[model samples]
Target: MAEKIIKGIVIDRFNFRDFDLIVSLATNFGVIKMVARGVRRPTSKNIYILNPGCLGEFEIFLARYSNKLSKLKKGECFFNLDLNDKKIYAFWKLVSQITRETNFVPKIFPILEQSFAKINSKNADAIKVYTIINWIKFNGWIANLTRCRVCKTNQRLINFNFYGGMECVYHQNPKPFFRFGRKELEIFYWSSSNLNTFLEKVDFDYIYLVFEILKQFLKQNSYIFL
Candidate 1:
């Protein structure tokens, strides 16, 4: 097969015997793993561009099968997020780990770029919550929170059913559900529509609530969490 030039974000890396390493990157094609021979050596030129969370153009010798690792011929960095910021660094790492390996997710790149930009702007909490919600939304796990899934009523939704989706007080059933207070529902609705605005004014409690809900949902459905 012909060599392909692709741009991607280096999300994770694993050291191999001696001076080699395996690097995983997120590209338009999906998550790709490539072998970087001798990159662990002190004098290796590829080390700089292979840093985790670095976005760059790369020359990849594509593998015949998606599960097999490809050969990385060369790479040039566009940008590398400062890994010194422990919070943001950890957040991106988790995002990379939770994302599916071989599947295509069209919205992943924009959401990741926006997330990095938001962290660079120092809006850490807001952007973290916003990014997670968008991830869930793009993955098709988010149900319409504004109306009841069954009755299609505009009444307040207070119960969350993994099997049946969001529900109202009058539509309760035997399925297990997560109950939310009125205040939490209001915040959920507001945040979904006006995430940027909510970020500007969100308090710690609001951020905590949003994360709790999202974490549980993700863990239940995708078996991944922050």
Candidate 2:
């Protein structure tokens, strides 16, 4: 078989014994796993390129027996990414944890790259929130907040159901779910707008509100709590 090269970001990695590793990467092609031999040794040059959030090109050998796994032969870093900030570090950790292993999404790689670029800037927290919101949207996990999920009419929705969506006061259930009002709607509107412009207008506080709503939305849809 021929060698395959791919550009991707290291999203997660695991140490195996003394000098080997199992790495999980997100590329335009999809999420992939590979084995890196001797990377943990003190003289290894591949260590920097294998860290989570490092965007790079990987040269791998495709084993004839199993195409699902690859042997990492070489790695080249695309950019020097700063992952030392605790906030940025935490965000990447969460991303690695929630992302499904072996699932392929063509759009995920570019989005991850753009997100890391933004978070590396001075407005790291705000961009982190933006990235999370975009992640949810890219995955199609959001519910329509502008109209009623049942009646298909635009109204002031007062409640949200995990299975259903936004409900008007007349249609809402007594049990606890999510409650929305004018303020929440405004936040949703802002979140849906252009990210660059939206970041200029809203601070982290407002973004956090929207983030919490998105978190709940994700929980109901995928049963995964972020």
Candidate 3:
């Protein structure tokens, strides 16, 4: 294939051989894996752009007749979050853990980019939760939190099942993954809104709750992760 440029995030990277690296990039097309040859060498300029959560445009190539791994020729970093902060680091780590080519979607790329761009010291916690929720929603795994899955009533959706379904107290899963009280339910309610509004309305105290809930939600939905 001719050389092409793709704008995306470096979701995961690992040393391949002596001086090469393998990276997974989440792009509009899909989750693409490419080998960056000799990027680990002292003379290489592309090494730093392989960091997880680095947003950049990569020049890539593949030969039509070959079945070998695709090649990443060079990269130009747009920006990368400061990975030293614990929350920011955790957010990118979670992103790498869940994202995969088999589960790829077009909207995933922009959502990841937007979340990385918008996150900062002030709103790191909420932004991480917001991005995961958005990812879950876009992947069509999020349940209708507004109504009970079985009873079809909106009231008292106090239980969340592992399969991503909601149920009221009147109808509950035999082994529900999470049982939400009024407060937890409230947190989940606003989590569906746009990121900015969610950050504005939800107290910092509740952001951790949302993050825990989303974490468990994904834990149960293991197939969604890589």
Best by lDDT: 3
Writing each residue's lDDT as its tens digit, candidate 3 over 32-151 gives 778999999999877888888789998999545434677898898988988898877777676766566655667767667777768887788777776776677677766665677777
- Residue-level lDDT of model 1, residues 173-224, one tens digit each, is 5555466666555555554554456556445466667677777776777756
**1 or 3: which has the higher lDDT?**
3
lDDT of each: 0.71, 0.67, 0.74
Clashing pairs in 2: none
Quick one: best TM-score, which candidate?
Answer: 3
Q: Write the per-residue lDDT of candidate 2 for residues 81-143, one digit (tens) a residue.
A: 576877677566555654555333455556566666566545665665555555555666446
Ranking by lDDT: 3, 1, 2
Estimate the TM-score for candidate 1: 0.71
Off-target runs (Cα >4 Å) in candidate 1 are 100-107, 120-122, 145-205
Report the lDDT of model 3 for residue 203: 72
Single out the weakest 10-residue window by summed lDDT for candidate 3. Answer: 217-226
- TM-score to true structure, per model: 0.71, 0.69, 0.73
Off by over 4 Å in 2: 16-18, 63-68, 79-83, 102-106, 143-187, 190-195, 201-203
